[model samples]
Target: MKLVKHWIEKIFATITEGIVGALDVFFSSLQKWFGVGSMPYIFVLPNLLIFGVFILFPMLLNFVYAFTGGTDFFPNRRPWVGTANFTRLFECQNFLVPNSCSEDLFWRAVFNTAGYVVAQVTVMVAMSLITALILNRSIKGQAFFRSVFFYPVMLSPIVVALIWKWILQENGLLNAIILSLGFDKMPFLVDANWARFWVVIISVWALMGFYTLILLAGLQSIPADLYEAAKIDGANAWQSFSKITLPLLMPTMLVVLVLSLIRAVQVFDIVFAFTGGGPGTATLYMVQYIYNNGFASPTKQYGLSASSSLVMAGALIVLTMIQLYVRREDV
Candidate 1:
C-alpha cells in the first residue's frame, strides 16, 4: 500500500512539474513577444480562428446565400435578391393556415416536424425513463440485457433504417408472418399515416437505449440511503419513485427531453432510407424538405433552402437556450 501510494504521488508530482515548466516557458515567450496582459487573448486566438474558419464562416456564408437567388454554387455568380426569398416564403393570407402560403410544402414540413417532435420526444423519454427504472433494480442477466438494448445505438442510422425498411416492406418478414396468420400483406411505407407512424416508432426504438443509458446513470447516482430511509417510513414503490426518483432525476430528465426534441427536429436519415418522404409528402419533415429543395428540386432553390435552414437553425437556437436556462436553474 505504501509503495503504491508513493508511486502515485511521484507520478502526480512529475505531471505537475511538467505542466508548470511548459506554462512557464509559454508565458516567458509571450512576455518576450507581447506582454502578460495579452496572454488570455493570445491563448484564445487559435481557438477563435478555428471557430471562425469552421463554424462562423460557414454560418455567415449560409446567411449570405439565404439572401441570394441561385442555381449556381458560387456566390459570385448567384444574383442578389435581398429578402425576396423570405417575402415569397412568408406570403400567406394567414400564417396559421399553412395552405395559404406560397411555400405550402415548407409550412407542411414545419407542421409535420412539430407534431413528430412532440410525439416522438414524449414516447422516447417515457420509455427510456421506464427502462432505466427497471434496469436500475438488481436482476439476473442485467448486463446482458443492457448490452442488448444498447446494441442498436452502435449501429449506423441508415443501417437501422434499412433493416427496419426490409421488415416493414410490403412483402417483408412482418407481412410474411401476417400472411401465415391468413391476413393480407400491409403497405406499411406506401400509406401516409402508416409511414409517419413507423418513422416515429423506428426512431424511438433505435434511440431508446441511448436515453435509457443516460437515465440509468442518473438513477445509479442517487444515494441508496435515500431509498432505504423512504422504505423505513413505509414509502411504497409509487411514492418512492414519485418523491425520490422524479425529483432527483429532474435535471437528467430535462437534458434527455431537450436532446430528444433536438434530435427529433433534426431527424432525416431514417425517414429518408425508410419512407423517402413518400405517400404524398405526409411523412416529409423539415430537414428532408431542406434536402429536397436545396439539392433535389428541378430549379434547386438554394436561397429558399438556406431560408428554410435558418428557420431550423432558429428552432435549434431556441432549444439550446432552453437547455442553458434549465441547467442554470438546476444549478
Candidate 2:
C-alpha cells in the first residue's frame, strides 16, 4: 500500500513539474520574442482581446447602428439617416406631455425611469446606511442577521422579480394576509400608482442588501479609538456619527451612491419580470423602452433603440462625472 501511494505521489509531482517547466519555457520564449518591457502587455493581451471583442466592438457597432435607420438586423442593409433618429426622438409639441412627443412611449419611459431612480436610490441608500449602522453594533446573532440581509443579493434578478410578483399578485401571500386581517384585497400590480410603489419597494428590498454590506464594511473600517476619543471629548452619539463616522464614511457613501444611481438608471429585468411595464406602461423604464424598440416591437427599429441607448449612456456618463467631481472636490 505504501509503495503504491509513493508511486501515485511521484506521478502527480512529475505532472506538476512538467506543467511548471512548460509554463516557464513558454514565458521565456515570449520574453525573448517580445522583450521584457512588453511582458506586462503580453500578460494583459487576453483581457484586452476579450474586452475588444465583447465590450469595445459592441459599443462601436452601437454607434454605427444609431446613425443608420431600418428594420434590418444587418448593418449593411440599414441606410444612413445621420441624426434623424435623434431628431425624431426629441420631436415634441410639448416636452412634458407624453402624447406630445413623436416617441410617446420613450418619453413615458424617461419620466418613469426618472421618478423610479430618484425614489429607489434615495430609499435604498438611506435604508442601507441605517441597516449597516445597526449591524455595526454588537448584537446577538449579528452574523445570522448579516447573512439574512445579504441573502437577497445572491438571488437572480429574475428570481427576485418572480418572488415579489408571486407575493404581490391578487391571490398571493400578501392578499391572503390582508384578507386574514379582514382588510379588502388590494390591487398591488393592477393600479398604476400601486405598481409604481411596489416596483420601488421590491427593487430596494432586492438591492439594499449589497449596499448594506458595503456600508457595513466601511463602518467596520473606521478606527474604534475615534469613537472612544469622541466620547472622551463629551460627544453624543449623533455628534460622533456626524463628526467622525460621516466624514470618514463619505468615500464609501459616494461609491454606494454612484453604483446605486447607475443600477437604478439601468433597471429593467426585475421590473420587467415583475410588472411587464404595465398597469398601462406605468413601470416602463428606459432600458425597457430600448428593449421594446430593438426586439419586442412589431416592426423593430434598431436605429431608434441604439439612439435611445446612447442617450441613456450619455446620462450615465454625466452622472458619473458629477459624482467624480464631487469626490475630487472632497479630496
Candidate 3:
C-alpha cells in the first residue's frame, strides 16, 4: 500500500510540474511578443470573453427585446414599439388595487413579490440571528445541532419544496397528525392564505441555515476579550451582546440582509414546485410572472417578459442603492 501511494504521489507531482512548465513557457513567449503591459488583459481575456458572450450580450439583447413588439425570437424580425410594454405594465386605474390594473396579473405579481420580500427577509434575518446566537453558545452536542440545522440548506430547492408540499397537503403527514389530535383537516395548498403562509414558512426553513452559518462565522470572528472586559465591567449578558456582539456583527448582518433581500425578490423555484403559483396566484412572484409571459404562456409575449424583467432589475438596483446609502450614512 505504501509503495503504491509513493508511486501515485510521484506521478501526480510529475504531471503537475510538466503542466506548470508548459504554461510558463507559453505565457513567457506571449509576454515577450505582447509586452508586459498587456499581460494582465491577456490573462483576463478568456474570462472577459465568457462574460461578454454569456452575460453581457444576453443582457443587451434583453434590453432590445424589451423595447420591441416581439412575438418573434429573432431581434431583426421584432418590430420596435418603444415603451409600450412599460406603459401597459404601469396602466392602472388604482395602483393600490391590482384588479383595477390593465395588466392585473403583473400588478398582482408585483404586490405579492413586495410582500414576500418584506416577510421573508425579516423572518430570515431574525431566525438566522437567533440560531447563530444559540449555536455560538457553550452547549452539549453543539456540532451535532449545528449540522442538523444546516442540513436543510444542503437540500435542493425543488426537493425541499416537494418534501414540505407532501407534509402540508391534505391527507398527508400534517393532516394525519391533525386528525389524530381530533381536529378537522385544513386546506394548506388549496387556499390562498394558507398557501402564501406555507410558502413563506417553507422558504425560511430551507434557507435560514445558510444565513445562520454566515452569522455564526461573524460571531466567531468577534474577539472574546471584548466580552470578558464587558463582564469585568459588571455588564449583563444583554449589555455585553448589544455593546460587543452586535456592533462587530453589523457588517456581516448587512451582507445577510442584502443577500436575503435579493434572494427573496427572486424567489420562484420553491414556490413554483410547491404551489405552482396556484390558489389564484397567491404565491405568484416576479420571476414566475416573467417565466409565464416569456415561455409558459400560450402567447409567449417575450417583449412583455423582457420589459417585466427590466422593471424587476430596476427594483433590485433601487434596493441596493438604498442599502448602500444607509450603510454610508452609518459610516
Candidate 4:
C-alpha cells in the first residue's frame, strides 16, 4: 500500500510538472508574439468571448425586446414603441380585482418579492450563521450532523418543492400530525397568507443547509490564534464572537447575503411548483410572473415579460451594489 501510494504521488507530481512547464513555454511564446501587455488579453480572451456571447448578448437582446411587441422571435414589422411596455405594466391591475385602484399586480409582485427576499434572506443567513458557529466548535459526530443538515441542499429544488408540497398539503403529514394532536388541520398551502408563509418557510428549509456549509467554511478559515488571543484577554463567548468572529466572518457573510438575496429575488421553481402564484396571486414572485407572462399564459405578453425581467435584473444589480458598498465601508 505504501509503495502504491508513493508511485501515485510521483506520477501526479510528474504530470503536474509537465503541465506547468508546458504552460510556461506557451505563455513565453505568446509574450514573444503579442508583446508582454497583450499576452494578458490572450489569456483572458476565451472567458471574455464566452461571457459576451452568452450573458451580454442575451441581456442586450432582452433590453431591445422590452421595447417592442415581439413573440418568441423579434417581430420584423413592429415599430419601436418607446416605454409602452413599461407603461402598460404599471397600469395593469390584478385580474381578480375590478375596482381596486392601488393594488397593481406588478407592484404587488414587486412588494411581495421584496418582502420574501427580506424575510427569507434574514432567516436563512441568521440561522445558517448560528448553525455554522455551533458546528465549527468541537462536537461529537460533527461530520454526520453537518451532512444531515446539508442533505436537503444536495437534493434538486424540484424534488424539495415536491416533497414540501406533499408535506404542506391539506391532508398531508403536517395536517395528519396536527389532527393527531387534537388541533384543527391548517391550510398550509391553501390560504393566501398561509400559502405565502409556507413558501418562505420551505425556501428557508431548502436553502439554510447550503448557506450553513458556506458559513462553516468561512468559520473554519478563521485562525484559531485569534480566538486564543481573545480568550487570553478574558473575552467571553459572546464578547469574542461579537468582537472577533463576526468581524472576521463579515466578508463571507456578505457573500452569503448577496447570493441569498439574488436567489430570493429570482426564486421560481418552488414558487411555481408549490403555489403556482397562488391563492389569488398572494405568492406571485417576480420571476414567476415573468414566466407566466412570457410562456405559461395563453396571451403571451413577451414585451411585458422582457420588461419585467429587465426590471428585476436592474433591482438585483442595485441591491447588490448597495450591499457591496456597505461591505466595503465595514472593511
Candidate 5:
C-alpha cells in the first residue's frame, strides 16, 4: 500500500509540474509574438469566447425576440412590433388587483413571487444565521450535527420537493400523524394561503443548510479577540454578537442575501415538482409563468416570455445595484 501511494504521489507531482511548465512556455510564446500587453487577452480569449457564445449570444437573442411577436420558430421571420410586448405586459387597469390587470396571471405570478422572496429570504437568512451561530459553538458532535443539517442541501431540488410533497399530501405522513393525534388534517397543498406557506417553508428547509455554511464561514473568520474584549468590558452575548459579529459578518451576509434573492427569483423546480402551480395558481411564480407562456401554453407566446425575462433581468440588476450600494455604505 505504501509503495503504491509513493508511486501515485510521484506521478501526480510529475503531471502537475509538466502542466505548469507547458503553461509557462505557452505564455512566454504569446508574449514573444503578441507583445506583453496582449498576453492577458490571449489567456482570457477562451473564456471570453465561451461567454460570448453561450451567455451574451442568448441574451441578445432574447432581447431581440422581445421586440418581435409571433408563434413562428424562425426569429427573423417574426414581424417586429417594438415595445408592444412590454406595453402589454405592463397593461394594467389596477396594478394592485391582479384580477383587474390585462395579463392577470402574469400579475398574479409577480405578486406571488414578490411575497415568496420576502418570506423565503427572511426565514432563510434568520434560520441560517441562528443555526450557524449554534453550530459554531463548542458543542459535542458538532460535525455530526453539521452533516445532518447539510444533508438536505446535497439532495437534488426535485428530490427535495418530492419528499416534502409526500410528507405534506392529504393522505401522507403529516396528515396521518395529525389524524392519529385527533386533529383535523391540514390542507397543505390545497388551499392558496397554505400552499404558499408550505412552498416557502419547504424552500427554506431545502436551502437553509447552504446559507448556514456561508454564515458559518463568516463566523469562523471573525476574530475571537473581539468577543474576548467585549467580555472583559462586561458586555453580554447579545451585545458582543450585535456589535462585533453582525457588523463583521455584513459582507458575507450581503453575499448570502444577493445569492438567496437570485435563487428565490429563479425558484421553479421545487414548486413545479410539488404543486405544478396548482390550487388555482397559488404557487405560480415568475419563472414558472415564463415557462408556461413560452413553452407549456398552447399558444406559446415566445415574445411575451422574452419580454418578461427582460423585465425580470432588469429587476435583478436593480436589486444587485441596491445591495452593492448598501455594501459600500456599510463598509
Candidate 6:
C-alpha cells in the first residue's frame, strides 16, 4: 500500500509539472509574437488604413473647415476667419418672422435633438425589453409571433417612414379610424407637439422589434436551472425574475442601452421622411439641421454645419464613455 501511494503521488506531480512547463512555453511563444518588440503594425495595417481613409481624414477635414466661413462646398474665394463661423452660428436670427429676436437656431436644434434622444431611447428600451420578456415565455405559435415582432426590423427605414407618414397624415388611416370610433381626429403629424410625439412613437415602433429579438437571444442564453433552483426555494415568478434573471441579463441590457443611445443621437432618416423639420422647427433634429445647412436648401453653411456635426459627435462620445463607466461599476 505504501509503494502504490508513492507511485500515485509521483504521477500527479509529473502531470502538474508537465502542464506548468507547457503553459510557460506557450505563453513565451505568444509573447514573442505579440509583445512590445514584435511588429504589431503589420497585423493592424489594414484596419489602420481603412480607419484613416474613412474616419480620421474626414474628421480632420471637418475640424479645419469648421473654422472657415465658406458657404460653397469648393469655397471659391472664401478665407479663414477663426471662430467667426461659431460666432455667426450663435448670433444668427430665426428664419421665421416675429420670433426673430436673434435666437440661436443651432442651440435650439441641439435642445430638440437632446429631447428626442431622451424620449426615444427610454421608450425603445422599455418597449423592447417588455416584448422580449413576453416572447421568452412558453406560448402557442411562438415562432410566428417572433417573426411578426421582428418583421418591422427587416423593412427599410425609409419604407417604414413613408408608411407611417401616410398613416399619420391629416386625413390618414389613424384619423379615419378615430372618426369611425366616434371620436375627434387627432393631429398626429400636423401640430408641432403632435409631430414630435409621433416621431418618438414611430421610432419606438420601428426599432422595438429589432431590440426585442436581441434581448430575446440574451434571455434564451440564461440557464433554466437557475430558475428551477429559485422555484424550489419557494420563490415566486417575480422573485425568480428579479434574483436570477435581471442580474445575469444586465450585460445584455447595457449593450442595448448604449447602441440605442448612439442610434438615437444620430437619428436622421425618420425625421426627414415623417416631418421635414416642419411646423416651425418643432421637430428639427440636429442631424436635419446639419443636412439643411451643409447640403440642402436656402443658405448653405457647410463650415458651420461641420462644426455642429463635430459637436454632436463629441457629445455622443462623452455620453458613451459615461455609460460604459456606469456599466463597469455595476459589473
Each candidate structure's count of clashing pairs:
0, 0, 0, 0, 0, 0
- lDDT score, residue 49, model 2? 100
> Candidate 5 lDDT, tens digit per residue, 17-85?
999998997788879998988878997899999999999999999988899998886798999999999
TM-scores of the models, in the order given: 0.84, 0.88, 0.89, 0.80, 0.86, 0.79
Write model 3 residue lDDT over 1-331, tens digit each, in one string.
9999999999999999999998998999999999999999998999999999999999999999999996998899999999999999999999999999889999999999999999889999999999999999999999999998999999998999989988888989999999999999999989998898889999999999999998999999999999888999999999998889999999889988998998899999999999989898898999999999988999889989999999999989987886786577557
**Candidate 2 wrongly placed segments (more than 4 Å):** 1-38, 323-331
lDDT of 4 by residue, 1-331 (tens): 9999999999999999999998998889889988988977898899999999999898888877799874555555555788988877666455444234232667778878988998899999989998998999899999999998889888787898899988888889999999999999998887998888888888898889999998999899989999899899999999998998899999889889988998899998988877888899899889988888888889787888888898898888997886778567556
Span of ten consecutive residues with least summed lDDT in model 4: 94-103
Residue-level error in angstroms, candidate 5, position 273: 1.1
* Candidate 1 lDDT by residue in tens digits, 129-211: 99998898999999999988888988888998999988988889999999999999988988888888888999999999999
lDDT of 6: 0.83
Which structure is stronger by lDDT: 1 or 6? 1
Off by over 4 Å in 3: 1-37, 322-331
Clashing pairs in 4: none
In order, what lDDT does every prediction score? 0.91, 0.94, 0.93, 0.85, 0.91, 0.83
Give the C-alpha miss distance for residue 114 in model 4, angstroms: 1.2
- How many residue pairs of model 1 clash at the backbone? 0
If ranked by lDDT, best first, what sequence of candidates would result? 2, 3, 5, 1, 4, 6
RMSD of each: 5.5, 5.0, 3.6, 5.1, 3.7, 12.4
TM-score comparison, 2 vs 4, better candidate: 2
